[model samples]
Target: MHPVLFKIGSFELASYGLMTALGYAMAAFYLLPRLKKINLDRDTFWNLIFIAFMGALIGAKLLFIIVSWPQLGATTAEKIANIFRDFRYGFVFFGGMIVSVFSLIFYMKKKGLAVFKTSDFLITALPLGHALGRIGCFLAGCCYGRPTDMPWGVTFTDPHALVAPELLGVPLHPTQLYEAGGNLVLFFILHKLYNKPHKNGMILLAYISCYAFMRFIIEFFRGDYRGAFIFGLSPSQTISLLTALAAGALWIYLQKKETKNG
Candidate 1:
């Protein structure tokens, strides 16, 4: 896979960065017209997205650094240096999602916005954006998968790719594309669910539950170093389990509340 989309002299455009930007843009486009239906203004929505974006970047980076500290370098100084040098890559999606969701909740409360209602709209667009971002990960050779003899396994030959040297040219299970495809399917499911009458936070709950399940399964295929394991499960899988349980509890509570109100 090509990490550098294009390079001219000293200018290099990374496929990961480019796809990430496109993901944000795509999410924005999907959310814009629907904001009015939720009674949210463009300026305020933009500000909220900015806040979430900053929070996501910080949270994702911090989690990545913490989890990958041992693998960063041999010495403390090398680790610190590598952290800054490779800051552009190594992001944990769950970390970003946790921070960004909290950031949005805080902003919505301060702005007196209907948190659940607005989140329903935003959550529906998440998978759409995330799908594209995974494509970027595939191209950049980050978030790679374990060795596989499957016919569809991908081999990364590009030196610029972020795949480990030992994995280079080896057939790997293309986990990035697997997640991307799953996200695309989830996006459609969520979008369809969003259009139907439901509870305030049902869409959000559905996203959390479905994505956690998907991520939990996908973790098995992932070959990259995923933080420390808890109960023989990777960090993402642990979070996925916790998140899925939380979403299930919330769904049950919401359903009971709806039934009682009715």
Candidate 2:
């Protein structure tokens, strides 16, 4: 359970951060081949992807910070200081998704990439990249699940685990694995759909709808406090519902647009 994967002199490399970087590197490798297959301009795609990558990283951190803020807060200085103390932890996946997608859509507009079409292109990358990110989460032991007695459950004795020693020796759902499995399934579906003659944004619409639904289910097992319960569901659940609705609406609208064109 080495949370610190290794050290280079004074610099300690965290398994969490290193794995996340590897995930994106894998994403670039996978995405380039797909883009070339579709005849997208590699140079422009690379440059834009880099911007999207930066946006995703910053957005992920910002989202994590926001979710973890209540614990660190009262004043701006308090919040800023908290970041210095625990920056390597506390990132919320949904928050990063929101910011990263917004940045991508905005960048697409700037580059004259059709919003829907570009979104379709991104669908494949999103899930693949995200699955890798969740792998990093598992290594870091941050977004872990509650204690359980299931046969296949995992035990994180590492001090890195958000779970305490009292909670150790007990089995717990590997919520990170749950998310990674879901995202990988989503990657397969989106990649399969990418080649079909669906409408421009159908794949994205499908991915959003599917991933939102999946995340809502997975969040139940997470031990971290995610804000309040609106009608018994946590804040993340409520947001997932909204995203699901939006995805469904987008899918319907795309279907209608395709119909009209036909």
Candidate 3:
């Protein structure tokens, strides 16, 4: 794993940050031209994207700080300093998604955009971007996997890598790549589903359900200290369960509404 993509003098470029930017650019490329189809102006869309990005960054970092408090530092001042000391790592995807979705909804309502329609379009491109972001996580050695005896297990040797010190040079499950591959597959599935005529919120529902299911399974292989477990399930697993159930309920309600209108 290479945390620093390159360095010149005292300055260094982080692979995680660079890849994240690339991911966002790729997603925007996929979405921008289609703005006309959704009747959204470029300026409004850019503003919405910026707001979502800020919300996601703050939410994800806050969740990470909450869950990884102990590892951060012993004192409040130390913890605060630690947060700014290394801004490259620490993020929870679900936290970002949840806050970003709410931010987008608020912006859409303020802008008089069709919530479900715009959301569906946006959701379709999220997985494609997320897929690349996972690759960044892999390269940065954050969100690493549990120790494994599997033949495909990966070992981290870079001192700059963010993996746990004890886990260095040990073969781990490569959970990051697993998720990257899964998200790529999900992007295709969601893209195909988006092209077909469906309910206004169906694409978004599908993403929530499918990703929740996938993340639930992936959590089993995660090595990091996930926050307090509820009923023996990790925090993300609990969130995934709730998210999936919520998506199901929403799907059922939408179906009933459609049927009633019919």
Candidate 2 residue spans exceeding 4 A from truth: 73-76, 164-166
Best by lDDT: 1
Q: How does each model score on TM-score?
A: 0.97, 0.91, 0.97
- Give every collision pair in model 2: none
Native-referenced Cα lDDT, model 1: 0.90
lDDT of 2 by residue, 1-262 (tens): 4567878998988877887788788777888877755567888788767877777668777766766678677998988887887567667767777787888788888878788877788667778878888888877776778877788788877765666557665677889999999999999998889888877788888888898899899988987666665787876788799999998788778778879999
Better of 2 and 3 by lDDT: 3
The RMSD of every model to the true structure, in order and in angstroms, is: 1.2, 2.0, 1.1
Per-residue lDDT for 230 in model 3? 82
Quote model 3's TM-score: 0.97
Clash tally, candidates in order: 0, 0, 0
lDDT of 1 by residue, 68-126 (tens): 88999999999999988856798998889889989899989999988889899888988
What tens digits encode model 3's per-residue C-alpha lDDT throughout 78-161?
Answer: 999999998868999888888898888988999888888999988888888888889999999999999999999999999889
Candidate 1 versus truth, CA RMSD in Å, comes to 1.2
The positional error of residue 24 in candidate 1, measured at the CA in angstroms, is 0.8
